[model samples]
Target chain A: MLKDFFRTFSSMIELEFRRLKHDRTEIYSRAVQPILWLAVYGPIMGSIRAIPTGNIPYTDFITPGVLIQSTTFISIFYGLTIVWERESGILKKLLVTPAPRYATVIGRAMASGIRAIFQTFIIILVALIIGVKFILNPFYFVLALVIIFFSSGGFAAISILVASFMKTRERFMGIGQALTMPLFFASNALYPVTMMPKALQYFATINPMSYVVDAVRSLIISGDLTNLWLDIVAIAIFNIIMFTLASVNFKKIIE
Target chain B: MEKAVDVRDVVKIFNKNFRALDGVSLEIESGSIFALLGPNGAGKTTLMRILTTQIGPSSGHAYVFGLDTVKEGSQVRKLISYVPQEMSVWTDISGYENLLIYSKIYGIPKEERNNIINGVLESMGLHDVSNRLVKTYSGGMIRRLEIACALLVRPKILFLDEPTIGLDPSARKVVWEKLKMFKKDYGTTIFFNTHYMDEAEIYSDLIAIINRGKIVTIGTSEELKHSVGGEILHFILSENGLHEDVLRELEGIEGIKDVVVSNSDVTFVVNDAEMILPHIMTFFNKKNIFVRRVSITKPTLDDVFLKYAGTRIDVSGRLSEVTHVRRMIRRG
Candidate 1:
């Protein structure tokens, strides 16, 4: 059974990888969008003195947030393909196959997680070019990538869970857009949670994206291990819940 | 002989308001090609999904090879493969890649996977285009590729829902030939849904006709055709049309089971065509209703359907004549 799970999971990931590889426009856009934000939006936002970053520059402060933003955008949109698959009847074909439901969803999450890492890499490279410095620890960098994968996976699960109910492209786009902005803004991705109003601050604190950004920031800028484990534990629990829900819902929607 | 599929009193309802499958039941003999004939929305696809283990029936049971489809879906899947109504292949990927993915999913050992993919592709006559993206292939090639993928696992039973729905006649023939070869070579039980009655009549060993989510009839071509136990008579009028008295006069003739009059033709179902032809000709002679042409044929599956369902299976508009009088049959 374990062999079956891993075989199905790897094949699904491979399918997604091949699909993205052939899609030049998607790869180009995925690579270009984050760099644009890093080079364009980061400079403009960094100049504001009102922004709170204890010692790190605002550009560096927003770097982790931008990485999380890129991950959120990519992960949320990953589900649009599921809607397309449903329309094209691929989902029906796959559902009839022997592949496990959770494996299929996990493979998809891993694929988009891998894509999120590439997009994050582009943002980080642009950050270096734009004069943002990191602690340059290999361990922290690997830890940051792990955080990105799970956080992106958590968001991808939410996207897939909602997507399973969407039978049409227009409905998927509407829900995706509705969820994307709120998830990004409610978290500390673009701003400090301390600077937000009380209600928004409350949402930011519980938001999984907040933990991901905090974890990344701690590893890269401050080189602080404090709160690192907390963020990891929180994101891990969030992923498990979201993934279990998504997998269960995936089978239900088809029925 | 083992039964490849057994569906007993299966009922499927959607949203508590719609009953998609209403007490549908059927049994398909192992290693025989079975075709399901139904009009649109007749629950053919629903029943196929149930047997394929993609969905559960609202009530009752469905089994494939003695295993309950709902309870032993994984075991059932190992013994069967499905080709859905739609084109399920990834258009952007090469045909080889598509087969490779399925081979892995089917858990073919790593060493034999490539050989099985190659063998299946070659058998489907898709080897030449194996490296080409599916989008570049013609509709027929894509359909063949779907079959090739299904065959990689060497499933004992292959379920195809409208396997050749939108293809050209030649393409449809190619798909059928491949399916026939697959059946012959491996003795695979092939169950399929088709809009083409002629295809169903010719290719299937046993055919089951479903109407309004119930099995109207199940038999071989000859048995289904002979179900009505009569012959059909079609009379083409000489433009002057039928006399008002003709139907009344024909009803008086012995062995005439029923009569249906249309704009330019009159069709009759009778116990024996030879016995009734002379009486019908004499009646037309007396009424001055010109019979331009007369053709007598053994009962068709269409007649079997009209006998049971009270309407012709109207895939082709040839059943337009039946439509005009179908309500009369229903009312009676």
Candidate 2:
């Protein structure tokens, strides 16, 4: 049984790699959009006011948030692949193939996670070029990457669950884009939670993306993630809940 | 021999009002080509979908390899391959990659997958286009590739729904040839659904005629043609018209089973055309009506559909006529 699981996982990775190699334009757009956020949106918040978590340059402040932000935005594109699969009838083809049916969704989510990491690394490299001090610990960076991976994966799962319920690509795009902005804005991606009213602060505090961004921000900027153990446990619980909800909802919607 | 697939009085209603399949039932032998023939909306695709565990029957049950379709879908799904009517391949992947993904899913060992993919592609005559993205490939190529995917898993029972619906004649012939070869090689039981009567007549060991959510008849093509028992006489009369009573009398004359009137053209299914044609022509002559034209032919599967399903190919506009297909073939 364990052997079967690994076989499915490896093939799924191969499928995702093929997809990445298959679409060069997707690669360009993925790189270019986060850079656009880096070039423009990352600085506008800088000149306005001292960022909530202290006098940290707004770039460094929103840097982790922007990575999570763009990653979350990119999460919905996973549904575009699914929508195309549905239109091309590939979903039906995958449906009847005997083993590892859920692997299709898992493969896609993990592929998009890798995509998120690539996009984040690109943005971080840009920041590094501008002389953001380098942190020397590989373990914390790896932990931070895991936090983003699970966060983006939870978001991708929800994206797929939504895609299963939608019939057409156009409809999914419109609805996916519409939902993305509100969810991103509600979090601390653009501004810290203390900048918000009491009610919105509660929501931002509970936003899993907020936990993810704050955790990563501690690693890159402060070098000590505030209450590092609590951050780890909280985000783990969030990932469990969201992934579970997405999988349960995934079966119901597709059926 | 045990039944490979058995659908028992199955009924599928989509939204309480839209009835897709109504009380349909049949038994498929372990290793034979069973063709379901009908026009669009005739419930052929719906029945296939239900049999393949894609949907549930509203009022009955289906069994595959002695496992209930709804109750034990995974066991059944493990053994059969379903190639749906739509083109279901990734537009961006090569035909070879498509097979690779499915073979992996079927848990073929890494060492064996390449050989299996290559062998299937070579047999389907797709080796040359194996690396081409499916979206850029011609319709026929994509279809053959889908057939290759179904075969990749080496399914014991294969269900192909309108497998060659949009292919050119030459391409369609190639697919049918491959299917015949596959059946011979593996003794795979094929449930082939199609709207093309000629394909059904040529390839199916047994044919089931479905219409308006019901199976109207089922038999070997020869048996169906034999059961209809006669020739068809077609007459086109324009300037003169016969009284309804007179036409009725001619229709009742012993040799005929049914009379079909379309505009001034009257078609009749009669047992003995040598006797009926002369009588029909003489009746028109006695009425001083000019005979525009007349033709007669032996029983065809089309005639069997007309006789048993209460439909005439030309007059029943509810379904596309054979003439439409003939025109398409001519146009192509």
TM-score of chain A of 2: 0.87
Candidate 2 docking category?
A: acceptable
lDDT of 2 by residue, B206-292 (tens): 999998899999999978886887678888896645678877888777888888877778888887777878888888888777778
Model 2, C-alpha of B31: deviation from truth (Å): 0.9
Question: What's the lDDT for residue B251 in model 2?
Answer: 72
The candidate 2 chain A region of ten consecutive residues with least summed lDDT is A246-255
lDDT by residue for model 1 (B175-260), tens: 88888987888999999987568888999999998888898889997778767887899999887455666568678788888888
Candidate DockQ scores, in order? 0.40, 0.36
* TM-scores for every predicted model: 0.86, 0.83
Q: Residue B23 in model 2: shift from native, Å?
A: 0.9
Clashing pairs in 1: none
